[model samples]
Target: MRILIAPDKFKGTLTARQAGEAMAAGVREVFPDAAIEIVPVADGGEGTLEAALATGGEERTETVQGPLGEGVEARWVLTGKTAVIETAEASGLRYVRPRVQSALSAHSYGSGQLIKAALDAGAQEIICGVGGSAMTDAGSGALRALGLRVMNNDGARARLGGAALSTALRIDDSGLDPRLKDVQIRIAADVTNPLYGPDGAAQVFGAQKGADAAARSILDDGLRHWAELLHKTNGTDVQIPGAGAAGGFPASFLAFTTATLESGFDLVAELVQLEKALDGVDLLITGEGSMDEQSRFGKAPLAAADRANARRIGTVLAVGRSTLNLEDVTGHGVKALAAAVDCAPSVDEAIAEADRYLQQATVVALRNLDEG
Candidate 1:
């Protein structure tokens, strides 16, 4: 039998690659002779670097400004002429313990620094993974790091971070790095929120980033004003989908450079060449740390299952846990779900030994598939 084992990270435990290995090991116990292939996946967050590296990518690390302006080390993956950058590695919430005020002060300059490093390394294309950002500065800081300048009324350059956005009056992209003119930027974001207004970065995602009602209000106004400047200085439009992601990072990426926003999952799928991997494969197995309605919205497992279904291949999932029962997802792309918790003593136990439990659960799910 030919099998494809693909899975996302198990969060605190296994990485996407490790999860695939454990699931394959379990399958080997049941079908040692089974020809298996493993492809790890991510949706543009923490696991992205692993997924990229699994596909013959190289790693490069650099030290840059953290969200709160302290120095932090971050890394990116390079595959050929393409570089993959995980935004969270540089400007994520974990770098600065988030408070309602964290949103205002956190800057995404580190992400920009990474971009500069990638460009310096002769990367002609960049895939920026936009997730878990700590800033709400509309990615101005990132642009600044790339040679764009923002000046306030005093003709003095504005500071970086969300709080400083309120003072931005004009922008000067005349100093934008010339390499940026030739480089292609693909933003890996999965959401569709715009730059400002009710469903925008500040109003929808600010409170969670440490913004209260008043702070959210301030951030929203900041974003609006920033958008106007972006339009004036660069003729960039912010009404597009994904403009609000990473605290409006895409908004600036759009205004300041030539970029296209694509689903992180689709981008990952393309990177791994999933279509070719699925050729002649009999069955597919996939899962993540969690599974439910949210997975249907562009998560890797369901995305892979959808591809499997298209090819008439049976697919099974073994997730860390699930709030919805298997029946809830019946006929919804997955053939079945084997939750690790169901095979373990407790949820904590499942997460602690996620590799073992997920492997065990995959064993059961495969047995059931074989029986039926």
Candidate 2:
């Protein structure tokens, strides 16, 4: 049997690579002579940089500002002149448990610092994976770090963060880093929310970052004003789909530079050459930390299964858990389903020793597939 084990991160427990390794071990147990190929996948979130590095790249680490201006060690990858960066490495929600007020103050300056570092390393193309952010500044903080000045009506520099963005009167890009003028920025994100509205950035995702109803209102209004400022400064429309990702992190890049948004799963899949990896594979196993109806829309695992279906290869899913039963996924080319939560004694135990539970679940899923 030829098996390809490709799984996304098991969120908060195992990384995509770790999950693949565990699944690979289970495959070895069930099909002792099976030819196993592991191609870890990511949907352009926490593990995006790791996925990029796995394919081929020179890893670089730099001390950059955190979401709340604290220093943090962030890592990125350079493949030729193209640099790959994940916003989570610098200004992710993992750095702080923000309250409504703190969420207003969180900024993405660290992400910009990473971009500067990439530029310093002779990068001309940047793949910015935007997600897991802890801010709602419309990427102004990042642009500020790149020398774009936000000013108040009184001709003074505006304060940083989302709350301050509400007072932004004008933008000064004269001092902005000229190097960015020649850079091509590709934002990898799975979201499709606009910059600001009921279905937009703050209103849709604010609560997850600690914004209350009132605070969400403030953040959404600020995003609206910031979008106007960007449109006035440049003829750029920052309210495009996926602009709301990572707290509107793509807005600044879209306004100030040549930036485009692409599907996170597609970008990562291409980066890892997932198509070539699926060639001639009999079974393609893919999954993530969770599975549900939402997983059908651009999530890595389903996307992988879709690819497998195209090649007439059978696919199985090994997830941390799932809201859907076996019947719910059979139509999506999933031949078998294995959830760690079902195999382990408890959900907590499954997460605590995710590698073990994942391995055991993969074995069962494979055995079940063989029988079917």
Candidate 3:
């Protein structure tokens, strides 16, 4: 039997590669003679850079400012004329501890610095993966770093960060780097929220940035204003689908750069030629940190499973946890589902024992694979 293993990162526990290895080990215990293929997947969020870099790319490192003005070293991945920039590398929430989560004060200037560096390096196309962001600045700081000035009514340049966005009155784009005009910018994003509304950026993502009720309202208002200005300056609408991604980074990029939004997993799958790997596979195993309703909406595992199902291949999902309704996934063609914590002392313990649980689960699952 040929088995394909493809899984996303298990959040705080294991990376997709590690999970695939563990799952492969379990399958080997059940069927020692079976052929297995492991393909690690990412959802264009936190692990995007790692996934892209794994496919062999030229990596460049630079020192840039962090979300809260701290200096930090970050890296970008380049493959031929295409440059990959992960926003999380510069302004990710991981840089801020729980106690220091401050959406109002956080900025995406460092991400802009990386973009400038990529453009300066003569990249013909740039892929900006927006995920794990810590700010709600609507990409204002990023634009500033790229030489677009945001000024208040008094004509002074606006300060960096989301809080200063409420005071922005005029946007000056005269100083935008000339090279950026010729570059194609693609935004790899997973979310589909618009720029402003109930499902907008601040309402859907601000709480994670440490925005309380008042802050949420403030950020929402600021984003609305930013969107209005962008709509006026650029002829394109800023309230399109996925405009709220990366705290409205997509909207900003759509307005300023030659940008288009695409599903991150789909992009990765095409890049890695996952469909080609599905040929002749008897059973396919895929997973993520959690399996839920959202998983159906272009998550990495779903993408892999879909490709495998197209070939009439059986697919099983082994996840850290399964919050999805079984019926919901049944119609979509997943053959089996398994969760890592079979019998754990506690949630913490379950997380700590994820690899062992996955291995054991895979062994048991394969035993019943042909039975059911």
Candidate 4:
């Protein structure tokens, strides 16, 4: 039998690439001679570069700012002249884990550094993956890193992060990277949330990044003010879909440049040529760390399953855990779901040894498929 293996990162445990490798190893134990192809995928959050590299891209690294305003070396990928930048590398929540929780002061300035590095390297087009960010700066920090000066009425630069945008009086693009004038910047967004409001970035994603009720409210107000300032300077409409992504990271980019927002999954899928990869495959496996009702909202695994189902190909999800009922999962065109937690002694233990637990889970999944 021929099988296709594709999975996303397991959060704190396995990366999409690592998960695919583990799944393939388990599949080999059951079907020693089976034809298996592993393709790591992401929903434009983290692991975007790995997805790009899986389909043929080269990676490069440079030092940039971290979420907490610290310095960090981040990575980007290049496919011809098009550069792929994952925001999580420099501005993700992962860097401040265990102790740091609040994204109130997290900044996207480091992401700007990565973009500048890509531009300096002769990239003509930039595909920025704007998910998995820890900052709620509405992208002002990223703009500043790219040479735009964000200043208040006092003629001083504004502080970085979402809360700081409240004092943003004006943004000057005079010193902005000239290459961006001729470059095509695409915002690969995984979420459809708008910039600010009830369902906006600050209220929806802020809590996870360490924002309290009071902090979220502050962030929301700041985003409102920030949006108005941007509109005045460049006519940016903050109501656009995906504008609220990664704590409004795209808001500034959309307002300041001729950037366009597109589905993060579609961009990664096109790079990997996922549709073509599924041809005549007996079973296509795809999954993420967690599968739930939210997965229906433009998440990568659901998209992968639907594509395979259209071809009448069987699709299975080998995930860390699934919170959805059988009907909801089946409705998404997924034939089966296998969770690693089921085989693990405890959730913590499973996460700690994700590779071993996930391999055992995949074995069970493949065995059932064989019997069926």
Q: Which model scores highest in lDDT?
A: 2
Which 10-residue window of candidate 3 scores lowest in summed lDDT? 96-105
**Per-residue CA lDDT of candidate 4, range 1-372, in tens?**
889997888877898989998898888888999999998887887878888888688888888889888888899998888899989898888887522245677889999998898888888889898877888888888889888998877889888888888988888899988887888888889888988988999899888888888888888898999888888888767767789999898888887777888898888887788988888798888888888878898888888888888888887788899897546767666676689999899998889999988988888777877776
Which portions of model 3 show Cα errors greater than 4 Å? 98-101, 343-345
**lDDT of each residue in 1-372, candidate 1, tens digit only:** 999998988887899999999999889988999999999988876788888898999999999999999999898999999999988899988787778777888889999999999999899999998888899998888989989888998999998888788899888889989898799999988788898899999899898788999989988899988888778876777867788999989888787678888998998888888889999999999999988778878888888888898889989988898887767765655676788999999988998898899999999888877877
Number of the top-ranking candidate, with TM-score as the measure: 2
Task: Give per-residue CA lDDT, model 3, range 194-267, as digits (tens).
Answer: 97778988888988888887787888888888888887776668888888888888777788877889998887
Task: Give TM per candidate.
Answer: 0.97, 0.98, 0.94, 0.94
lDDT scores for all predictions? Answer: 0.87, 0.90, 0.81, 0.85
Report the C-alpha displacement of residue 276, candidate 4, in angstroms. Answer: 2.0
What does candidate 2's lDDT look like per residue over 147-208, in tens digits? 99999988999988888898999999998899998998889999899999998989998999
Clashes of each: 1, 0, 0, 0
Model 1 residue 213 distance off true place after TM-score fit, in angstroms = 2.0
**Cα RMSD, each candidate:** 1.3, 1.1, 1.9, 2.0
What is the C-alpha local distance difference test score of candidate 3? 0.81
Please give the range of 10 consecutive residues that has the lowest summed lDDT in model 2.
Answer: 324-333
The 10 consecutive residues of candidate 1 with the worst lDDT sum are 326-335
Q: In model 4, which runs have C-alpha deviations exceeding 4 angstroms?
A: 97-102
Give the TM-score comparing model 2 with the true structure, all chains together: 0.98
Evaluation by TM-score, superior candidate among 1 and 3? 1
